[model samples]
Target: MPAEDDFTVTPYAVEGDVDYDRLLEQFGADALTDDQRAAFPDPVHPLVRREVFYAGRDVDAFLDAANAGETHSVVTGRGPSGPMHVGHVFPFYFAKYLQDRTGALVYVPVSDDEKYLLKDESVGAISDHARENLLDILAVGFDPERTRIVVDTADADVVYPLAVTFAKDVTQATVNATYGDPVNVGLSFYPAVQAAHLLLPQLVEGRHPTLVPVAVDQDPHVRVCRDVAAKRRYDVDKPGALLSKFLPSLDGPGKMSSSADAPGILLSDDREAVFEKVRTRAYSGGRSSVEAHRRRGGNPDVDVSYLLLYYFFEESDERVERLAREYREGSLLSGELKEIAAETVADFLEAHQERRASLGPLEAELPKFRLAEAERRNARRRAGFPDDSLAQQ
Candidate 1:
């Protein structure tokens, strides 16, 4: 899932409480409720607020400034492990919306590294498909020039020497403290590289994206970035982070990944396939029969499929509220609700596929200086600059 990760980047956001009720009020029925908000403890709280979606140390302060029209930038990422899935749409769509509404410079990283570890395949074989894959991502309809998606592995080869130099500066205790296991060295190295990517726009001399928006599981990684940035030994940009939860999969609680490693509800899945999957495989919390449902109501908490629609559809307000009302009143039938939820989810996936097929390449090309600057910024690190490591915020 694009939004869910334990530690793919660095500079962890100091965790804090989020005002979920206000989020639901701000986002209306579209946001998570107070009940769900309480499910996550302290630092996890504010990360999923309605307006901000997710929060961390830099979240509140940056947002305060952003509302005043400050020129801060935000970064979000995508893992190039496989074809983007239905669940992947939420963050991209969300990112597109945030950029359009706020007019902030957005930096998007196509995280090929995570895929290197998560999947059996290498990205090199898919080189030709990179443009095609990104075109599909663009098809989802965010402003073409407002965002940047770097093919991380390609950049990594050029950036790794600096990454290694930075890694050497972090001690085993710091690494072990943040990540409990000492065996996962590769995962540890990824955070630093991601931290470097966070500062890439800044390294070029003019652009500095100060905020990063990602899913909640990824908070650990950003916390590392924040921790390291405080020390200021390197030229790394310490970005504030806003997080969102994994868009629950059709089958379960996390991001929807294809079970057999084939295509999922692609930003390209066809109508027939969409309906078939939604009706047959999507998670359902409704009971077996109408009478049983009337007596017990539908179970929304464990209902994965409905939640899928809840997170994706724009028209969800009335239907979901009504469904919830019926369930609570013991007058709703689970089967019927599931059918509606299936339709809602299927329609969303179908629409995404259409939009994706019609999209174009980036309109405003990235400034050449941006890439060169990132190169030089990394080059400086390779020239024996002291590395500062992440600590808990």
Candidate 2:
């Protein structure tokens, strides 16, 4: 257990049980009020309804724009350090939901450069991961017309220049405070690149509310970008944030596993592999004996299996509630709950794998989602660069 002041949450690390409420106070983000939740489009996403997306910064402004049918965008991104797990793709799906409901533009940035700076991997290795991850992202079925996918290295002509302008506003001390001391200069400057990502939609589409949906641990990155936006160097609002709790890891309640060796249910995992991982590794809150479990009932709140269902897989509110009720009343054993969750997760992955397998070559599928020539020019120009600056060559 972490002491009250001992826990750490950062873009790259999350440790100990996170106190989401305290984090709101600490991060100066507001809890998602009932009114805010209700303001979402009819049939609010389960993530928003369940309070998985529990807190935010400047969310009301984005909601107001969304409600008014004004131009708005969502910036949710990926760092292609390795294979994406279930945790990695949840936000993208949530972003897609918002796009479908509100017609919001979605900007998905793949931060290959950041991965190269932060991980112990070569550029080629990170590029490999980026290509693999791109296929998975494309498989999400975002509208090619409304969604623009930017790979940092591949789109460096635009990404690098905007980051350079934003970098001028951030200081080394701020970076250190937000993300510890940098191991290398590339990382020292990566926050600027991140700020560019958060603000890309505005840069390309002109000033409008942009929302970044991310886990609470990633709030510091948003805050850094917010500060850069506040500098008024760019005609953009501080990108609003929709913060979420860490998804439960298979081993127990903690950050979802991203380590290659960790037992994560990957998007590409087969149905049998998904079941095997969950049945064998999912942490449960049941008692030592069946008799004891039946007598005392299991705790669904701490059970990873129950959490998996609640988080993303089981979408029906009534079904999820019934599962909880049965588990808490001793009618559903922990193993039984685990099986239910495994089935739900497996069903989701099976569909996802099917879509992924059907995709064409990356080179062919990616062009439709890449930024158009005008968008690149506008983004560069908006970031204070001349239209011809680093013009893709």
Candidate 3:
């Protein structure tokens, strides 16, 4: 265990007790002020309203464009290194919430290429994971017309050329400083690809306010891309960022993981599996003895079950507040709280699974969400490649 002030949060690793407020200062981001929060589309998402997405960079501009009924966008993506987990789905759901409310264009970028560089997995294995991850993303039910999904390996024709255009402006020193000496040349060059992903909406349509909803640890990626956008090499806005707290791991207060070792609640888990995991593995904040718990109450703040509900599962503020009050007052047992979280999470998963099952073949369903030919052409053209460029051919 690390000392209280010894936490390290980077794109590759997060450890110790994360001081979220301190992170905002270190990353040079602003906390979302109340007025900025109010400016979000009405029926504000619980994630935003409850301050799960606590800090941001240039958030007001994105909200401003969104409010004005302009071409605003939300770029939230996945790196398909493994199975999708509850923690991994938060941003997509949050983006969907904003899209439903404000018609924000959504861009889902799958970084299969980056995952291949970072992980020991074979290309085939990574491709398999990408296919599975894409299904979960598709199951989120983003509007096809308003959403575009880009797979780095699959869409390299466009992604690569755009990345190449940005690569010229990104230096190895910047990549090393941002990501702490990437392991390979591919990793070193990925920031440029990420810049392409961040600027894709602008490169395809036109310069517009784009917001990236991500875990605070991933803010470095946004910062790096912001630097690239600041260079003025391309006609694009510096993508704004909305940073979120890590969802508590099932065992404790750390970022959740879906790797084989840590084993998170997978998107494929059924209701029975969800309940069993919550009952058996969820970290609790109750007293050691029943009598002691009844006398002293519990701490919901550190309880994984309660935090899960507070973070995403339970949507109602009143209900979640009541549950917390009951727990803190000792009227609610940790077991009961786990049960509620299990049921709520299971309900959510079942709905998601139903959507996943109802979808047709990936080939049939994915075409509508993939970038159209003209959009791809425009992106390449805006990235300094002309229509007659060899890359375009």
- Candidate 2 versus the native: TM-score? 0.97
Enumerate residue pairs that collide in model 2: none
Quote the lDDT for 357 in model 2.
Answer: 92
- Candidate 3 clashes between residue pairs 3 or more apart in a chain or in different chains: none
Candidate 1 lowest-lDDT run of ten: 9-18
What TM-score goes with each of the models? 0.73, 0.97, 0.98
Runs off by more than 4 Å, candidate 2: 1-4, 388-393
Worst 10 residues of 2 by lDDT: 1-10
Highest lDDT, which number?
3
lDDT of 3 by residue, 320-348 (tens): 99999998899999999999999999999
Task: Tell how far residue 258 is off in model 3, in angstroms.
Answer: 1.3
Which of candidates 1 and 2 reaches a greater lDDT? 2
Any idea what lDDT model 1 has?
Answer: 0.56
